[model samples]
Target: MATILYARVSTSEQTLSHQQTQAEAAGFTFDHVLADHGVSGVAVKMKDRPEGRRLFDMLRPGDTLVVRWVDRLGRNYEDVTDTIREFMRRGVTIRTIINGMVFDGQAKDPMSAAVRDALVGFMAAMAQAQAEATKEAQKAGIAAAKAKGGEEGGVYRGRKPSFTADQVAAVRDLLGKGLGVAEVSRSTGLSRQTIYRIKDDPAGASKALEVWA
Candidate 1:
């Protein structure tokens, strides 16, 4: 059985390489590493992501999957729990580094299965709650910053924009040239959702960029 490490990161903090380094530092070795980067846990379902889908197809019975935490596996309660149960059904073992949790295929009896499912459900709910809580906190922080304004007491620029004016311009230019959102994201290194947001509301995006600038 091969040990595969799956890593995922939303734009907030984690990165693929960074996760791998941390796992290694924690002394976990793996035969393969899969990553999904810049994918939002709240918005993107695990099954929909590229690497996530690949990991789903690649894993087989007797394979062991490792992750930094249950959150990396998924953030939606339903999806997370379903995915874990499916993996367990397929004889795949799921392990987490955070709590050193091990969920294996040993749960054959009904009672054992019920207990395992309950635990999975609880963790899945917690993961989704944490993701939502983080989003709410960020929104509140931005709102507070906007209300407080700058040090000079002028209009508050909520937060700095991740993309520069030139980058936004580049995206717009590519869009004007009729490039698809996926292609634009590939060429500009921006997330597909970000491309769609800019594409859908160019005026609003431009206005925000100007305010932040």
Candidate 2:
């Protein structure tokens, strides 16, 4: 009956860490936390993600799973609803930080079940809508950035990385030792995305000052 928090970080600079902080501040405590980094919640299915599969395996009957929101479960409405229903079927209690909401399967009454299902569907739809909105916003932002970059003397300066050289090296070392990205993030204070960026392309991800000289 452990209380676990699952979070997803799409990039190193993302504020996913605040999910945990906010939960704690809201008087919620977790015995463990599982996170997936550098992974798009919009595109990736929860079960396919590295840490996400781990979560499915680790949780047991009577355990509580806490997420910042239902969207963290998945982006697709069908996928999110299915996952939540499966968890509830397993006697797992799912909670959200945004509204401090809980979805439980303990209610045997037909009306209670109907209400729960309806609410779950609503949340899942919202999650899917949010994901689509985010993708559109990202496309607009990139277009804007490109327009600015093309201006005279305006080099296309990329966003600065959040990790340091030493941190990158440490992450590389950990990956070399076969440590999983989530574990590395927990052990090194580096976001899973940052660690994966280093793992995928150490040289490219280096924080070298080589934008425009």
Candidate 3:
């Protein structure tokens, strides 16, 4: 009966911390959080993903599943609708941070049931449509960039990382303890994305710090 937050961190603009903050701002708190980094929510089915599969086995009746939105639950309309219905059938409450939408299967009234099901279908359709649109937009952006020219400055080394050498060590320590990204972010006063970068490549992060210094 634990409240779990499941997030997919793929975009550079919206990292795991942003999702956690958004959920917190909506007055939602979780006992545990699971995230899948670098996984495309638009292309991959939820159950096929690593942490996504864990959500199926880890969640029990009376437990609550929180996501940033319906789109975070699946890759397509059918997938999202099916996942939500299955969870509701198992008496698991699903919540969205976007509009504070709640889907429960315990409703005895037919009218309430109809409304809930309708909303689910509509949101799932919208999620699929949104994913398609985003894909097309990315394609266009790439085409436009190619038409313009190649990189002006040979190879671009990204901006300097936010963490110091000591901070990187601290991040590694917390990560070794199996702490969640959000928890590590809070404990070390570092951004969740930074923690993720370090977790993925500790030595490279250390080298980057030295190079910038």
What TM-scores do the predictions have?
A: 0.79, 0.78, 0.69
Question: Would you list the C-alpha lDDT of every candidate in the order shown?
Answer: 0.83, 0.84, 0.84
**Over all chains combined, what TM-score does candidate 1 have?**
0.79
Q: After superposition, how far is residue 66 of candidate 2 from its true place, in Å?
A: 1.4
Q: For model 1, what is the error of residue 170's alpha carbon versus the real structure, in angstroms, after optimal superposition?
A: 4.3
> Candidate order by TM-score, highest to lowest?
1, 2, 3
Q: How do all the candidates rank in terms of lDDT, highest first?
A: 3, 2, 1
Candidate 3 lDDT, 87-196, residue by residue in tens: 99999999999988999898899998999999999999998888889889988876666555455533333457788988898888888899988798899998666777
- Name model 1 segments beyond 4 Å from true: 150-153, 169-205
RMSD to the true structure for each prediction, in A, is 3.8, 3.5, 5.6
After TM-score superposition, the amount by which residue 96's alpha carbon in candidate 1 deviates from its true location, in angstroms, is 0.5
What is the alpha-carbon lDDT for the whole of candidate 2?
0.84
Give the better candidate number (1 or 2) by TM-score. 1
